[model samples]
Target: MSRSTPNTAPDGSSLPVVHVAAGVLIDMQEKVLLARRSADSHQGGLWEFPGGKLEPGEQNRDALCRELEEELGIQVRRARPLIRVTHRYPDRAVILHTWLVTSWEGDPRGREGQPLSWMPVAELPHWPMPAADIPILRALDLPDTYLITPPGFKETALFLRQLQQALDKGISLLQFRLFGLPASGHEVLARQACRLCEEYGARMLLNGPLKLARAVGAHGVHLDRRSLMALNDRNGYEGLLLGASCHDALELEQAQAVGVDFAVLSPVLPTLSHPDAEILGWEGFSQLSQGISIPVYALGGMAPDLLEQSWKQGGQGIAGIRGLWPSSV
Candidate 1:
């Protein structure tokens, strides 16, 4: 077994330790190599990406070359580091260092006694994988700018009246993320919200509850980072849009790889809610969005006025809590 070690996060926390390594076994078609874990190991009998621990003082490229050979028996000539994923399990955590490896030498063989599967990019969700891997899967499948709900003032009777007034004023897409409501009340509210959205020819994403989304006949699902990480078969929930919230380059890359229609990149600006958290300025946003084929919306402290600026800076659109929720058109 590969020796485990403590891995520090960017924030200097040790709560979620990861074994940093890279997996670079992809082709032109964007299909990637997947390996099932042997039933003997931790999270055994489950599917996992192939890679291992990075040695000290080793750069990503060198580590990938070493780990691929050690784990998969394949020699890599060139590999491109694409994404990084940190997964927290019950006992331990692992940081999956992913790379878009287009070229390699020799056919990959599972020398580790685990079964191998060649998965197309679009079909990646079929296999059971670690929870953290889900965002990557959705990102691989989706595009940008999915509708967030309650486009105008939220649906208090008065708020609902105001929202109705704003619909014709041009709030086209929305997601109903109403929390704290009883299930029965939620059903009624969701139906009402859905009707309003539909009347406007807008789309709606149900937050936190796929079953509720299905029950409410929503146009899609807005997966929080947790939900995105936990989902294995996004394709199984047919006809519903799959969207995710992303906070970093790694999450964005995974979202794109998994084919999520669009993703929200949040905390572009610091907020009162999370004052301690660092905000990724436009420059950081640019770095993350560059070369990504999917559309990225600037989330956190963004407003409708910021849309034009965001687009000029390569963002698809803007997403916000207070900025996009008011009754004003």
Candidate 2:
């Protein structure tokens, strides 16, 4: 009998782990650079982001820079960590340290005789891509911040005014997080919120109870931790975009297993809302996110300034109530 370990083959041999650093070069037109893989290599005929494997004792940034210079005749001037993904094939496993390169020195010529294309993010889906690269696509599609509506929605006009302000300030993703409203109150408020979100071209999610999301024509539903755990039958979980609030690795694993569109992992930093709560910090957050296949947002104490920090720490973005809400509101 063959027993397969997490990182071991059925034959009792360790699977080789390949460490790669890939770069997504963005142009002013909101397109990302993709190079066609060699017909002789693995995942041939598929388009991919440019990068190479890391050498022994080498850093990810160093490997990324060196590979870009060698393969594309360019030097990365500005780059930010986007996502880290670990995937296993039949023969081996791979860990990708992906970065978004906004600025570079030279024109990116395919020095390796590879073909390159500047493809829009929306169009990239139509092209066949490696399974390992799919997570990167998800990250690119998601916004850098998620807004949770402030707690005082009982003042309906004031809440709408504040929400409009937040949207005008460039919040493309939102969650209507106000709680304790009557069903009738919820229906009324949700319809108004949906209109505002539509005007701003933003996607809005209702917090939990899938029926409410459908009734109000929300773009998605975000399940609280309790609701996430209570789900038993997978039979009725489709047709709408879904998200979940995850506190630890177990909840995060379940979030992915149940096919959430994204997740919010909270308490990454100390915050006024949960003053004494244990914080995950960057290390803990990264450890949790690295295993997650879907987009994961950092929640506690996040702000505009911390957006890049969240990206570098293996997050899809930052999600928060106070951190994202307008101070005037």
Candidate 3:
């Protein structure tokens, strides 16, 4: 539903070529189907939300039927619009139309010889995915808040403990992001944090540390803008939730391509972290959130009290470290 870049022709020419891709959202017992791509292709070996490029004259549903059949060897019995996104990669531009297809026939086999897997929704954060997919993940789970944090250390430990107390008071989903910590220290803190999250039955997303997420048994991994732009597709990891931090519409589309669960659209308000960054006010936030099928948490200077306002302006919730862990809301 978000467009990061303007549309363009696909043949490396100036003529406009609107690329339409149709995808199906297969929900089965809380698990969804995903496919891996051949590493040699545009997005090789990456696991992706199963769907394919649309051909000329094909309706959205018709295109979905064809792609699912060709790629997964299955027939969709029912399908409905879920979301639509437009992303322009350097090499290709695509308009992605997605549908929620809850019913189907035949077991999903990777007809293209790409690997196939059924992933549980709750476990979506662990995969290595494209950045644009994050919002979709958010759409599926609908977490109330996106918790950001500084590095894990003795000083931040108190903050985390305070966060833990907040979790006890009903903050179920959180991200343990420490950009400044050493790898070893991060692992140690992640392991400790995982214990707390598990105790509270809360979900934790590690920012930019897929390996550490696995090592510490965290719920999932969060990708920043840089990590996502580099990925061609998402398909490898068998089990895990993948999240992303996205700044624009194109990134959100890419996140969807790689099957990210949810995303954080930042700078809803300016932060001390980057005082010069332009804030995406409620108007801008609404514009972005409107196009996204997945839930979007308004980041940058979010406070607990902003929840109602965010939802009113088309946000799922608010995500922040300072506002989330403060002694008062």
Candidate 4:
């Protein structure tokens, strides 16, 4: 067993990366399996998803299967890629290829003499985990489709109706970007929308000032590019989900540095509203996202059909205003 340190690059530049396969072992009751590392082990004393490092020349899935059996006494029968995370610590770096264990044989018990527990997903954030596992937790909390409200839905009744329809259809994550409304009007509609969101068990974010978000009881705020650049730290916004709109690598870096929970990287494809703006294309988007641990949503000219494509290109999911919302409720 070894103590885990912050993954600092060797020679103060680049660290050797070890590829590892990990799993989120879920049981029939919907509780996820968690194991505590031995006190002398790397990332010691923290609870982590059960799985282990990939063996040399082994495929990721096969490695996960082998690791789970050796460490947890379970046989994985069904699993799928959940998220890939690349993290660096002071002493080492790792690429965590995580999967969602949908089906497995045998009850899970720590075969390595470590403590094991089953936890609900909602309780994950309360436990102490490694830095590398933070993004995985955030990914679990988010949905595959992120919706943004169109700019000028002035009628509160109509907006609420449309929002309800979307929510009914299972749009769990949304950002209310009503920029055209007056301050007073925005506040009123925001409160109404928050109430509506609660009814559907959806999370709502306000795309405006932090004060306004707090006043209206939003789950978080989506900072525009300008607001994102103006922030130096994420001190005041602790405990709330913070997100931002990013256009390039620099903006994405800034978002990560400020401790944003997630980000929307836009113009992946040409948009009807901004046809002339430069697009990131899938290749460019993938290039920029390498080694970035934060979850990203692909925006601009996106629809539900492109959800898989978004994930294939290193995004958590897709975000769109027109593509996600119906023209009329």
Candidate 5:
């Protein structure tokens, strides 16, 4: 197994990080279990997924099963990786390995005498939680596949027709990346695409300027690495969903620092378009993403069928251009 490198502190010192295995136990009603940390513990009083530190030589799944049994008094019968978050606090860093416990024996109780509750998924954001849990919520809200538009289609009518077909087939999250088009043309197509997406109750993100995204009434903007690096802060994007394209760990860190809602980490495999680009195999991707506290989509050479693989490797989902766009169209 690959291990993540320690994070550097502000003064250029390495920070010791504890790896924790946590579980999101969802009941039949779809409400998720949350536990409040003890007042004297680190990040005390914050609501968190019930879990504990991984014991030496313990596998993540075994650790989760052990923690759930000990902390919640439930034996995990079935579970899977949901998300992994790495958060840096002033004193120490933590790598939170979160699992979705689908089935368990016995009912959950606060075996450790901690405060516990099962909150509706919709209400999760309103509750105060540890900083690391934010991305877990976001991951839960997103779909398994994110579609990006290719620049091949030159006509707006043709593009919209294809997009409608895709939406009809249940592609809910889309990125309108009309690169190299004239400003006027791009805006016109974007507005139409946004309207089309709204009609389907889907979300459309413009892969261009923030102003263009807003002007066209897009749900958000998808920034390239250049734009991500150029941004000074996340103030103006408060009302919108922000996503960034990242190629490496440094760029992923930058994206997280700027408060983007999610990120697309690319070249997880060799791609037809960028065939020569360096690939981050599943191991490398997992290692690089270990401490990231944001939903990351595996972007290069991905298809809907790869969603399961992506999840196992700690990705929220898979994102692609060619793979999602039907060749028959």
Candidate 6:
């Protein structure tokens, strides 16, 4: 989700898109499998998820199963869509459809005479992987649910109680977004929230200025569109998870240029809170995934039940306030 450019050729003409299917196969101890590309082949010497180019009209799932058997000698028992990366090189553009192979039969080895390795999931980021395969690592790290804090808290004590309840229910990622609050109020609230998140092993992203997000000890900073644009150098934000609110391809590109870790695409469906807001509908939501290489969460009108549907349409997960918040509380 960090870097990307427009998918066009040197002459500014559109390039033919190549479709490939890849799989993230994990061992019993939960290490991810990666294959090294042949030294003479494209992106040689770099490790990648096991996969290959898809034949015309071949379904992604079918290609994954066929490729896994051919390349690894394993039968995929269960698999699900993980992420789709659309990357462009000077000569070609590629749409890499990745799947999570949860269960399989037979051991995985390099049948194509290439080397294979298994590494801890956290160590994947340090491996020399192709730019397109980096998003797959981020997808593997993200959870299935994201929680946004309630906008207004009438009583601070009551809000902390609700926040603790949500944490206890196992919501590990949260956004502390409160409108109409002064700087002093934010500082006080953020410290208390940070303590609770630490106790429960959850991460809290402050939805405010970066300075305050750091001073208050937040795990990350979640930027709205304007703040996302203001960011230039990413050096100051090292080790903090940077997320953004993106609505269109342009914003997504900007988010990538600014080194954002993830994004939340909103208004996937209508909401009572903002009745007049335009909804993306599922089809529109899917289109946002076309050009970007980041983990995106469906944000408006989202609930637990819609998690699978969001995944099918190429989302990292679902993020919400009313729908997800009240339930956990």
- The lDDT for every candidate, in the order shown, is 0.68, 0.85, 0.71, 0.85, 0.86, 0.85
Model 6, 103-167: lDDT tens per residue?
99999988888799999998999999988787788889878798999899778888898988888
Clash totals for all models, in order?
25, 0, 33, 7, 0, 0
Ranking by TM-score: 2, 6, 4, 5, 3, 1
Global CA lDDT computed for model 1: 0.68
User: Model 4: runs farther than 4 Å from truth?
Assistant: 1-14
What lDDT tens digits, residue by residue, belong to model 5 across residues 1-329? 22334466323558777788889988889999999999999889999999998877778888898888999899899887888877777777777888888899998999989989999998999998988788889877778789999876857677888899899999999999877887898889899999999999999988988888889999999999999999877988878989999989889889888889899998899899998899998888776665477889898889878888888988888999989985555
What lDDT does candidate 1 reach at residue 258? 71
- Candidate with more favorable, higher lDDT: 1 or 2: 2
Q: Give candidate 3's error at residue 72 in angstroms.
A: 36
RMSD to the hidden true structure, all candidates = 10.8, 4.2, 9.3, 3.8, 2.9, 3.7
**Model 5 ranges with Cα > 4 A deviation:** 1-16, 27-29
lDDT of 4 by residue, 111-194 (tens): 889899999999998999998999999888888899999888757788888999899899989999887777888899999999
TM-scores, all candidates, are 0.53, 0.91, 0.58, 0.89, 0.88, 0.91
TM-score of 2: 0.91
Superior by TM-score: candidate 3 or candidate 4: 4
Instruction: Flag regions of model 2 displaced more than 4 Å.
Output: 1-13, 232-239
Q: After superposition, how far is residue 256 of candidate 3 from its true place, in Å?
A: 1.8
Backbone clash tally (model 2): 0
Q: In candidate 6, which residue pairs clash?
A: none
RMSD of 5: 2.9
Query: Tens digits of per-residue lDDT for model 3 on 266-298?
Result: 889988877998888888887886565566778
